[model samples]
Target: MNAEIDFAPLLPLEWLAVLAAISAAAVVLSLVLRSPGWALRGLAALALLTALGNPSLTQELRDPLPDVAIVVIDESASNAIDGRDAQTEAAETELAAALDALARDPDAPMEVRTVRVDRRSESVEDADQGTRLLTALEGAAAEIAPDRIAGAILVTDGQAHDPEVFSNFPAPVHVLLTGREGEWDRRLALQTAPAFGIVGEEVDVAFRVEALGDAPEEATRFARVEVRLDGEIHTVVDAPVGRTATLPIPIEHGGSNVVSLSVAMREGELTDRNNAAVFSVNGVRDRLRVLLVSGEPHPGERTWRNLLKADPSVDLVHFTILRPPTKQDGVPVFELSLISFPTRELFMQKIDEFDLIIFDRYRRRGVLPNAYIENVARYVRDGGAILIASGPAFAGVESLYRTPLRSVLPGRPTARIFEQGYRPEVTELGERHPVTAGLVHENAVQAAPSAEDADPGEGPTWGRWFRQIELEATSGQTVMSGASAAPLLILDRVGEGRVASLASDHAWLWSRGFEGGGPQAELLRRLAHWLMKEPELEEEALTAEVAGAEVTVTRRSVETTPGRLTAASPSGETLEAEFVEVGPGRWQATIRAEEPGLWTLTDGVLEGVAAVGPPAPKEFENPVSTGAVLAALADASNGGVMRLADGMPDLRRVRPGRTAAGRGWIGMARQEAYSVRDITLTPLAPGWLMLLLAAGLALGAWRIEGR
Candidate 1:
């Protein structure tokens, strides 16, 4: 509250000065005459004149308010790694306790607000300590009264990725750091590899190796690195630390190749998981040429053409056997009805022109002699892919199963044809197999409502086909099963070529909506891709994906369920990890592969996954400290930026509108503007008697003077 005085007079200051001069004159005359009565009269007139001026007092009222404290907590991925999670937990506990104690104290007079800083899914590089602090302060000021907020405290590891954008805080920011100063000896890193590499070509991969922590300044360490191609060691080298090593790795084959790089940590390192990494590089050939041979015109003939035509890189030569030699459709000899089958030109003359041959619902229709089928088998044996989609004709007298081509087929067809509707299901071995894994009906279903909600009696849903050839399983893998666990799909390798056999020709019904439709296109697409040696379909594959410095290592196995994974660096140091089930039958593990080198990750069964080169590109690789990020906010708003290396500072009170940091915690000292309303005002004057009172006073004075 404040108070002041204001005075109002009916006469001007000049008139008052003249009256004082007249009184002084009277006093002088009295002194000259040696009379004390004149001096008494002059003093009385001066006192009466002063009483005519009016004065009033004005006062204001105010109430005190509480102050606020802002607490900022870091919740990024780095804070969850190593022992930092425990440190964060401890800091949260301490902060909560501190706030509770302050709230209970009678003299504290402070309110606590907390802000959590986490990774924003949209921006991976924006997680910084200073930005979070400034953001918290701005939020607190807007929500709470600025005069109520005292200061702020931040909890983090001090490893801010973006340090340039700090500033704009209006309160003091104190930091509570998490990690201790420890030696982090990491291998140098090469972070990423191109997705596709040409076969038999040399590709340059970028990588760097550095020695961190209390590494001997003058002493150098040798890291033995090995590059593996398709699970086999293709190249090996020994490189020194703290240098950039360029490795020229050759892409050996046209397939999905897994390349891995590993480097060993020093003897007394804290963690060994950062020593290795795995990369997946697709090996592509210059071109793919396919030869399509159709037995006759059928409803499903366009399916084969559409599948091959979808890929821009595929060059297709299609030939259809319109009429078999034995079928006598009477016509003139010179009539041009359809082109000849051209068996001699395609099979005997130019057999090696295509990389793959597809026989869609083909049969031994006497279109080509037995010798032509033999030649086709030889062509497949010498590194060609053959796919046979069979119809009911395969079980009839014109069965191709009786031809020389029968040897490459995964199953032998029986004369009997059993037709029934059945859902396509993965066999026991196919669940863990890469080609069919995660494709079963149960797995395809979205979220499971509950464990008990799964229908046990309802068989898998599949459309009914009018005809299915009975088949006897052979040496190759039985990838799909039907009612009573009968083989529906089979794949086998003959020499260097691959062959697949589907027991039913009615699979097109699934795409045609015969019952509830399924992902028919997806199924057929995966089947064709697997036959083309796509890397994601390998039965036993090792691959890893890198996010920042962390690598998620996955080992895909068709057989021999993997147990534990042991990753060894190029320097021969090994770190053991357990495989966690990520999906139905896949096992995965995450490791922080901080360094760049050849990392070899092997399970106990001699199978391994490797990252061929180095760590990935990251913005916050170097370690440095700068206060510029938070300086502007601290300076403009009178906030103090204190380093976590120093202990937490003492809290202080400051007057509002003053600089934040003066001699004490209180800002500059100044009184706040306050006022009280609803004031009462009453008149002290009445009307109609002023003239009579003036006349009576003048008459009395004149009478006294005359007497």
Candidate 2:
């Protein structure tokens, strides 16, 4: 309870002041003239003024509120290293007991609030922002009023990624570090990783093995690092620690090329997770070098040229034998076409330079000898790609099957030609193949094949072709069929190369919008990419995708049933997972990934790697516990820093603006915050009492004046 004096004037203040001034002047004049009863007149005036000024005694009943103290605990991955978690829990328990003790204090009580910063408690949105200790502290303090916040205490490894610094805190902030002194850590850090690199070229990835804290001199001298390309060990390199080493990784094919680097784990280091880092660089072709050789001038020849030329990235070298050596032409040599075909330079000298070779209606026309055709077959075996777009000539005496190229050719000509119009259909195997899967929907055409010459059953959804060569698929898988299910498109792998056979010249009919054009552009693009050995277009593949903490493994294969997949986590724990068929040939299985590192997936044949969280989690970047990260914050709040290894410090209540921390002790501010529960006002001067006193003084003045 508290008491104070207050006033409520009965008359206006201006009128009361005027009456007091007149009475004071009259009393002074009487004193100056030596008149009697001057003192009594002054007393009478003072009494009258006191009656108008209503004075009261105000009393307030207040309830003392407890000062709030927030404790922010760091439960991030970094805090889990080297017994820091145990230290944190101990500190939390000790601090809670201390706060409870302060709550029993009669002078200044405390309300303890705890906020834990952890990845498990995070939503998918802020999961990437690791170890936000200060952010959590600020959020916890926001709920408490500024005056009621006695102070905040943080128990962590001091690896906060949040850039927030509190310049003005309501009270002191103390930091209790969890780890011991002289702890060391070794980490693999990626300095420079290009987002893209040209296929077939080497991209220099810069990285370094760093020694943090008090790492031993011998441990920092040299480090053995393993370089992994696409999840497989590519090479082992001996790199000097603390210096940037550039590793040249060759881009073998187009699409995503993942490069993972790992330094050998030290026995006593902070963690092995940060010793490995993984990043992906997309492999792109500088220019697709394609050699398009046409045996004769045909209407469909322009279709191939237009498609290849439309892409600005393709470097097309087209050659047509308008007048072969056998043709007796009467035209002069100077009157012929400007440039001569460099057959020897292309086939013998620079054949390996081209990424893809296309033979459009090409037959044995004596322009290319048997040796050149054999060289072409050898090129396919040496990681080259070939597309054979055969016409009716494929079934004639001059067929390419008769040449040395037949060794790599996926199909053999049957010496039969179908002249009737037929709609091309994706085979049952092609429905699962990446190249032809969902091609029907992408064509965006619902019209049936040409009704006049269509097959008796429900025709294909695309347009019709007038002619197709009948071929027996001796090797490879048939992806498309025509004319009563004869092999129309066959794809195969020869050595390290790829071969594709499209047995129809009437593909141009679809390009010309014949009978509602099919997916000519889309189909040809996919076909070319497949022939060039694009990773996404592989017939058999193992792949994994990550969404938050779940890893979805997808297996695409041409086999009837894809077997189970064995997943090896970053910790080398293998798990056998069965697959469920989601699509035609695609099977998938999802696993919860609690770890944040590379996950290796394989089915004994194909292998793949997927990253669950960041390849190198930010939490483990600086796993060595220290007080430097929170030093500024503590100093700004006039607090102190101490290691839990030393001992749990005694908690004390200190006055604001004084020393809040000292040797062996930390302090919380003494906030006298309170709320008023009840108020009472007792009138000190009543109107009747003041009137009676004034009348008695006036009578005394009259008696003195009469005497």
Candidate number of the best TM-score:
2
Question: What C-alpha lDDT do the candidate models reach, one value each?
Answer: 0.63, 0.86
lDDT of 2 by residue, 236-340 (tens): 999999999999999987877878889878788877878998777789989989999998899999999999999898999999877777777788755666788
Q: Model 1 over residues 3-73: C-alpha lDDT tens digits?
A: 55554555787877787788688768867876535544554554445444334454544444546677778
Write down the TM-score for model 1: 0.52
Clashes (candidate 2): 0
Score every model by TM-score: 0.52, 0.88
lDDT score of residue 466 within candidate 2: 82
Stretches of candidate 1 above 4 Å error? 1-131, 137-290, 296-303, 306-316, 322-356, 361-384, 391-407, 413-470, 477-488, 493-497, 503-526, 533-622, 631-707
Candidate 2, residue 244: CA error in Å?
3.7
